[model samples]
Target chain A: MTTAEITVLNKSGIHARPAALIVQIAGKFSSDIHFARDEDRINAKSILGVIALGASHNTTLTIEADGPDEKEAVAALVEIFQSKFSS
Target chain B: MKVYSLLSLGEKHKENFSFKVLVHGENRNLSHATMNRPGLALTGNFQIFSNNRIQLFGKGETAFLYQEQHNPGLLVNCKKLMQEPVPCWIFTHGLFPPKAIIDLADEMKCPVFSSNLSTSLFAIRSNQILTDEFAPRGVVHGVLVDIFGVGILLTGKSGIGKSETALELIQRGHRLVADDAIEIKSIKGGNILLGAGIRKEVAHFMEIRGLGIINIPHLFGTGAVRESKVIQLIVYLEEWTDTTTFDRLGIERHYKQLLDVTVPFRKIPVRIGRNIAIIVEVAAMNARLDNMGYNATRDLDDTMKRYMEKNK
Candidate 1:
């Protein structure tokens, strides 16, 4: 599996709102997105799962995709991080 | 609660949402509700901007406001809207506060809340995550080559020929973790010391005698090396002299402190063609054996004591 890391930049941290937004974005992609904090891994599309991570802002999250569209999913997530979640 | 059902104005205000809101609360439920609830679920063209503020671009009249605090300026701005058709309120991190900003938000009827974290730390952490910009954790140590499955750390002075010995170890079917400066991190189990890989500019590549800057990885297959390894033992390379007393038996294992944990240590005397790599490898095996409940030094001491008792 290929993995990509993104640092959260929103002023509100990865609280419910940004996490919900991230979940929404992940839901749109066909590939399965798993986020890792240290050793804990959870489904990125799950709202409660992501929130349970308690991933505050600036925390580095590793996103792993294993399916066919893994590369594209990683690329898209990188773009979102680069843009600072403006869209 | 003076419910002034005022209309929003057409002219938009420019406000920066860069400052983080610190909502210090004794309870968890209030804290959770304050940050998760949507501020403005309006049906209008919106432009999300930096600093967590949104700029709405549309032509609507009578923008209804739904918030807890009442600000005269915000009310006045909304009252002047000629084509305001949506009601919106910006979400904050506090439920209620007793400060100048809270008073202002109250006067404007905007909600003020309390957060669990400090404002500055929250902002910095948030920015770091969204941006994917992180600085790798670093450390200071001397990483030597690996023998069998043991990672050996060579320590001494600058001119102790540590690098030269590591190169020799690599030539003997071992792997080099790092040279000169080695970065280590404790991961997973207790006191696991992992050495970092050498940078691309100076990888597999070693500075040695006869040959200069040779790439070992290129010459040998991937199995011939590892970029990093769990440091199992440390070998202190000392100058060779007849007077020097080395560890004749392995009863007591020497330890060196790093970060917070201590690693097993061995002192090796450096002389001409002493086969230091083999000895270091043997030291590592001995340490491993010690871990597996076998102490050669102690066993030899016990044997000698028994022999003396019998003779007596």
Candidate 2:
């Protein structure tokens, strides 16, 4: 499993669009990916689960993935958050 | 096999059904789930008689006893009926037994009860209680919730979010039946499975990962919890893995066996962004639709097939 602590940098936080971008990237990989916020660690590939987290701007989350391509999957998701979720 | 005692019958129905104890039997245990009227036995017919059941003395038997008040053979038949070592006797519809019959019951050390409830009502109520006592029961580690009047049992390994998902469902106005440990019973010979909280009073309490043991009724009010429910569907939440395959089409029905009863089943893959509560809600609604004899997946498939045939 690959784990990385990342902070939400976008002004709007990890809203629908940013969540969708994370899913788009996470979907390409075969690894099982999850994003943890405090007591909740939800599937990164699931848009609603992420949005339900209410992870607003500057919220710190832990992204973890396990499977054959865990490293690549985590890196891709981490990049999405660090890049300010740019379209 | 559970023993349905005559003592339980009187105590349980005493308040609501006005069951009054006239005499206490030497044998307080009842061996049958069904109550039988001893009209045939009272007529001096002991052939193929069930001597181990609760003898119900309704209006017909009481009327016969009155009608045979002057007959010498009447005393003999009544004595024979009371000596069968039967579990107990109940006189219904406010009819007090004849003094002679009560003396015979007292002498035989037989328990006797009288109730103002109609004979049929008493029979039905006794049957319900005895059936519950004799039904097969089991305990399952899951959460039972009532969604849209449908009882759904959420099952999976520990930390798979069964409680968390159930908590969300409760927040959505659904009632929780049992959390963590659900006591289930196969009713009607395993045709229907009824689920309740393990200890009953503690069934509404839930344990969320970080939130210790929280009482659902206290947190969400009385409307958020139910004492028991008939399990209509079972949803298994499995941790999503790369190689695992999930039911995408939902065209074919899947089932989970609970106490030898089969219930419609679904295995939902747990994903980070997936709103499992919504999925569970939809699954419950779909189960309700399925119970109503409608399958959206099959219906849409049939529509597509007909459309293709027309094009052909």
Candidate 3:
């Protein structure tokens, strides 16, 4: 299992489109990924779960992945958050 | 699920609903959930004709057919329509099927039925019946109630106060859908789950342990009962045990699977001095809020985290 903390930097924060992108990226990996904000944790691969987090700009989130490709999954998610989900 | 025959429809709704069989196509199947008014098809427009639907010929369509009886083209179009394997044809407002149409229906082995109901009334009643018949169904032992416009299925072991809670909810202005046995149907390709009583005679009747069977609609008026409701939540009641742990914070969500569809589920411990009906009401309202994108637990967590961060 691997975990990384990242701050949401996109001006619009994690809305529907960005959450959909996150779910898509999470689906590509074999790992079980989850996004945690404070006490609420949700399956990162589910678009509804990610959107329910309601993470806004500057909101810190802990991305946790568990599987053989956990490191790659966390790195990819952190990079997306750092890049403001442009790609 | 297999298609129902026209004879089955006549027999099933024999008591209240009436249908006069104009042509004997008893072997034809009615499979689809929707019925169609073949307005354009009667006028020789076969491009958008849906053959599988039960075609309804209302006053307008029947009038058109009557006016165009002598037109040879009309006979050809009617023949062409019956050529397709339609479920059946129904005439509303006591209108008789024209001889030409009836002849084509008999030749093509398509059944035709007539009803005394107005076009609008027949359409509404048939739609409701067909929707129920075609829905994917499963039976569950529970009490279904409508609280705050949300359907909550109270499921637990027998004698766990399921009906008692439902009765209280009914008394509190909520509506009772079903008790003891609930027939849940998944409509619109498993997108929605609707709950109804297993038997028509027992609908809206709850059997309390000491009070026996009580008709909720009769006791509390018609507003206390609902014919059917789309199930939105499942509340499983369990006796509070010393070792059993309950969900104190509503952060994580649970689901109960029924007929291949997953509905939101919650577990509430049944304990003395605890008002289960009020808790179920709040649960239903909270579920509505969750659907509207406002989660109280998550909001409280964020507030507490922000407060701690500022203090640190």
Candidate 2, RMSD to the unseen true structure: 15.6
- RMSD per model, one decimal: 22.0, 15.6, 19.0
DockQ of the candidate models in sequence: 0.01, 0.02, 0.01
lDDT per residue for candidate 2 within B1-312, as digits (tens), equals 466566766676577668887877575677678877788777777798877787888999888877566766877777666664578888899887778878877888888888899999888877776777778886666789999999999988656888889999999999999776566889875699999865665577665656555889899999999899999989999999999998889988888777678888889999899999999999888887877899988999999999999999
Give candidate 1 regions above 4 Å deviation: A1-87, B1-138, B188-190, B198-201
Residue-wise lDDT of candidate 3 within B167-278, one digit each (tens)?
8889899999877656788986678898887655566666666664577888999988888899999999999999999999889899988988899999999999999999
- Per-residue error for B256 in candidate 2, Å, reads 2.8
DockQ-sorted candidate list, best first: 2, 1, 3
Better of 2 and 3 by DockQ: 2
Q: After superposing candidate 2 on the true structure, give the runs of residues whose Cα lies further than 4 Å from its correct spot.
A: A1-87, B25-27, B66-80, B83-85, B188-190, B306-312
Candidate 3 TM-score versus the reference: 0.58
Best by lDDT: 3
Kindly give the number of clashing pairs for every candidate. Answer: 45, 7, 0
Interface RMSD of 3: 17.0
TM-score of chain B for predicted candidate 2: 0.89
In Å, residue B185's CA in model 2 sits off its true spot by: 1.9
Clashing pairs in 3: none
Poorly placed runs, candidate 3 (over 4 Å):
A1-87, B7-27, B32-86, B89-102, B112-132
